[model samples]
Target: MVDEASKDGLNALAQAAKQAPRDSPRDSTRRGLPPVHLWNPDHCGEIDIVIRRDGVWMHEGSPIARKELVRLFSTVLRKDPDGYHLVTPVEKLRIRVDDLPFRAVSLGREGDDLIFVTDVGDEVRAGPDDPIMVQTDPITGEPAPRIHVRRDLWARIARPVFYELVEMAEEVDGQLVVRSGGQAFPLGAVA
Candidate 1:
């Protein structure tokens, strides 16, 4: 028959997931390890960034016309870096805010570092050598603390989810496009 606790656990996980973007994960896998946002997915395909307001929107979720949020734009580059230069234009960006939604803090390259400036400055980074982290509940136009992770762990856990989400980010041709890292072994093409 049905297990009540098991059912409840699944429901709780779903409830938490429903509140956030797919693959926009909050992992507590290793204690004392500052959380890394997990995005690994099983399949690899075209992916698009979703701009949802209010709740977790779908693949075809519409952007709320808020200039305070970052709408889909041409990517300067997607990173798979052990090391990256902070001065690259890939870092500089801004997003418009609306009523309520799963927001992203897009930091732009500033001088010798990337500045994660947002209304809720929960997630931010100053440079390449910084940590890739997420902070809960922040204010507008504020800079978040730096997020960091070990490089190998990042590749192992982070990469696959990115492939899946990137696949879902599939409107580049007037939609998103799924792309693999350039140096990926066997070079996973958008499949």
Candidate 2:
């Protein structure tokens, strides 16, 4: 498998992506963010987090510095408040708690819609005209939360990222049925 990130030629589009395209009609709702490609030059030195719904995707205007993105996301996950929501182009991610090294993709904007790519390079993309729903970890059963974390002896990290995700997953049923929130979804389905 390719390295998680190997954007060898993605930097070339950074300058062009700096501003929203002049040709398209801007959506009043999007607040004037431009659509960038799968890879953009400006993001080369940045530590960005891609929402991992389908696979890998980037937000239209969320161009933060590399480390800042990690810090912000880390802090949010640590807070782990009830009813917390992380809205991306494709879905809204929310949960009571989350561990780190969480695998995900961003909601990359194409025209008016959003897309996602996974760590292993699978994509989940849908048209902007259509609505998509991704939900937070919901409480399923009354069982005590079970936390399972795998330690890597050789691969050291500041803290294990997957541990947080595992913690969040422990609170729910394996089925994880989420109520549908959009036209593309149906009732009581697993997201």
Candidate 3:
């Protein structure tokens, strides 16, 4: 159960997140992300924001419907030692993330680079800096694939996108591997 003060703080943070794009001259849908890492505000708290496993942003148990708003909020998202936080110049608010925060919804190839576009409009090229990682679920033994986006943030490759990657993979030493930016990332054992 949330206390009244917490509720108020959550609502206020939501409002602030909404207003952030309007406060900026550039469009929130633009490619560049805010300097969230640089901000070290004195005020810190938690809100009801949760990034679901499927990459949907939920607030107070409801989905945040606006794409641009979500994009704006994504710009300020940062991961610290404790957890993920939405950082601004004035305040910092921790948020819950069930899995990762972003989803790699689309994939494209340019030259030798594999470019991934996140749901919130981040374009990350899989390379040494942003490597692809596949982890096996210990319980289900299913493959969970992810790609690094920026800083410590990552985008879970959507199933269809992962299938696309698999389609592009080649068998190398009994393992399925995909090449991007001169790096070979193993998908899994070729079964």
What lDDT would each prediction earn against the true structure?
Answer: 0.29, 0.28, 0.85
Q: For residues 31-146, what per-residue lDDT tens digits would candidate 1 score against the true structure?
A: 12211224332222222223234322222244324332221121111223422111112121122213222233344443434333332223333234433332223665322222
What TM-score does each of the candidates earn? 0.20, 0.22, 0.86
Off by over 4 Å in 1: 1-40, 47-61, 64-116, 125-128, 131-191
List residue ranges in candidate 2 displaced over 4 A: 1-8, 19-26, 35-185, 189-191
- TM-score, cand. 1 vs. native: 0.20
Instruction: Assess candidate 3 and give its TM-score to the true structure.
Output: 0.86
> Per-residue lDDT of 24-114 in model 2, one digit per residue for the tens?
4454332233332211222123223343332123333242245434333322221112332332222224432122223333334455333
Candidate 3: residue 24 Cα off by (Å): 14
* Candidate 3, poorest ten consecutive residues by summed lDDT: 21-30
Q: Pick the candidate with the highest TM-score.
A: 3
Best by lDDT: 3
Q: What tens digits encode model 3's per-residue C-alpha lDDT throughout 1-191?
A: 55688668756765665544333336443254556666688757787889999888988888888887788788888899999998876789889999999999999999989999999989888999899999997878899999998889999999999999999999999999999989999999998
Error (Å) of candidate 1 at residue 136 is 33
Better of 2 and 3 by lDDT: 3
